[model samples]
Target: MSEFFAHRRPGRPGLAVFVNAGDPPLALLPELVAMLDENEVDCLELAVPFPGSATDGPVVRASADRALATGVTPRAVLDTVASVRPGLRRLRIALLADWSHTVRGTAPGEFAAAARDAGCDGLLLHGVPPRLRTAHYEAVRRAGLPLVTTCYAVSGPDAVAEAVEHGSAYLYLVAHYGRSGTAAAWDRKRLGAVTATLRSAASAPVAVGFGVRTATDIEFLEGLGAEAAVVGSAGVARMEQARAAGRDPVGELQSFVRELRTPQPSHTPADGRKRGIHP
Candidate 1:
């Protein structure tokens, strides 16, 4: 298990924030990661720049663009992560995997090793087969990193249950089957059922993402036994707002995080674990 996941066992859902490395700029990353830690994000997933993120929506795709435009290569991303990691003991990072096949002579093991050396907590391996090869998973395991996978566009209870049984280090449940955005009202009942099914099947905690935007959304996920709710578009919106208002984006982000982490009462997970506003 990754140190971060081991620190908190497989009970309640845990919040994991996805940030595009070099989004604002390479120089501003450390401060941004620090602010996220201060705001109570349990884990952070940094998306390394790729030419095409077919699954990402406007908010994240634009983030990718900025990062690539600034010449955010794998080495640079790893260096940035290493520089900032020493101070962020509470924040475990997951490196986003994309377009790995296109890299000449680069194996999946190489990417996992790079992430581990950069002090990442886990590997968010996207686009791989659902039933991953033992060698592939072992490659990540060798680096002391857990593998987190997403059930994108999948909504069946049985399917979710099966995913959990696979020893998923953590389950990334997409809030929408489509692209990422700022979502308002969600199908709480349906989501609740899915959460229940996932809890029943997997020992790993499950998190909801892709469309979560507000505190209410977070609260609803909490009610359903979701360990975490990720808000990407909203964060980008806040950054854009800060840029327009001529305020420091990082400063604005601090306030935004405060609002998101506001506490609430205990909720029940499908596994019957009590949910606390621990982070």
Candidate 2:
């Protein structure tokens, strides 16, 4: 099992933030990774830059555009991972790549091998074709790399089964099937049932993603049997806002992560920033 998922305890769900590898710039990622490690955040789902993603929202799509404009590539992302591996103490890096955009020319086994060689603790490949699913799983198995398989919350039995079976690290249970970060409301009842179902079937932990913005949402997911909440668009939005404002995106992230663990009032703000009437 991956170190991040090894010493699991029954408690509130863990937090995993996603970021485009070069949005904050590849040069500063090691520092950010170190900060996240120092804060003991569970996982950093680092995505390589890709264009025209069918599932990403504007926040994340904009992030990818920024990253790609800066010439971020799969090789650079993996190299960055390798550079930071020695400094890591607790935080694990999960490299998220798109099969169509990032791994098109490479074979599944080769891509898995490259990720394993690059010191990735886990991997989740997006946009995989149905015909290549078996090859993907086989390659991951051959490389002895932990896999993060995903299925929509409303996915049928076969899809869910494939996710649970191959997902040795964790199963990413998307909250709904729309573009990322666009859901106006979380389907609490449906999510609760599906989370319960996946947890019962999988030996590994099950994580919830998509439309998970607030700390309150994380709390609610914990109540519904999710082991972790993958905080994506919101995190990227915070980083982008901070970056544009001449603020430290990593510091902003640290604040965001801290807020997730801090107690809040009956209705906590989604952004978790305390505002003043005078300001």
Candidate 3:
């Protein structure tokens, strides 16, 4: 396992924050990455802008538009990661891209090599299904960069186990069954069941994401036995809000991170026995 995934311990669940590279602008990336690391963000997921993203919500789509408008290319995103890698010594950094972005008019192996050379520890192909991503997985493996795969609630234990057998650094579970940034409260019962299934079937850790917006949500995921909780659109939304208000985006992100890392009372029942949520 990479050092990023190794950060998880007994009591604390990991936090992964996502941001579109060059959304507000690429110049701010180094500082933003540094700030996240300083504030205890375990993983920094750097999203490369691609057109017509089917899974992106309005906030993420707007950020992608802004990034594309600023001429952010795959190469530029890689370069930015390389520049920030040294500063983020302990933080695990991963690149999130679509199949098109990963291919980039080159062979999959070649593209993976480029990303590895640019200092990314792992790669997550956002819209590609695990069964259909053999070539991409092999390429990432050949480059020695970990491949992060997504598992949906609907995808049963058999599928998740197969993905683990195929060698994923970790499995990313979609907390809800829709686009990112949807405001629905997570289905705690379903989430608990699915997480339990994944944990029992797979050796790799499971990280839940999609529609995760607040500290309470993070706490809930931790309670559900998730190895990490990913926050994408929520973080971007906050950054946009900070910029509009003439506030420091880094400071805003730091405040949010601190809130997430803060310890809170357990959700144990009054009888003092821990509730039966499967780990």
Candidate 2 stretches greater than 4 Å from native: 7-10, 265-279
- Name the lDDT value of residue 7 in candidate 1: 42
lDDT at 88, model 3: 69
- Residues 53-142, candidate 2, lDDT per residue (tens digit)? 999999999999999999987888889898889888778888899988888788657887888899998889898899988888888889
TM-score of each: 0.82, 0.92, 0.89
lDDT of 3 by residue, 162-200 (tens): 566654667788876677887755667788888988878
Candidate 2 clashing pairs? none
Over 4 Å off, model 3: 101-104, 129-132, 265-279
Q: After superposition, how far is residue 278 of candidate 1 from its true place, in Å?
A: 28
Estimate candidate 1's RMSD in Å.
5.8
Ten-residue segment with the worst summed lDDT in candidate 2?
270-279
Report lDDT (CA) for all predictions.
0.69, 0.83, 0.78
Candidates 1 and 2 compared: the better one by lDDT is 2
lDDT of 1 by residue, 3-23 (tens): 443443344335666777777
- lDDT: worst 10-residue window of model 1: 270-279
State, as a TM-score between 0 and 1, how close model 2 is to the true structure. 0.92
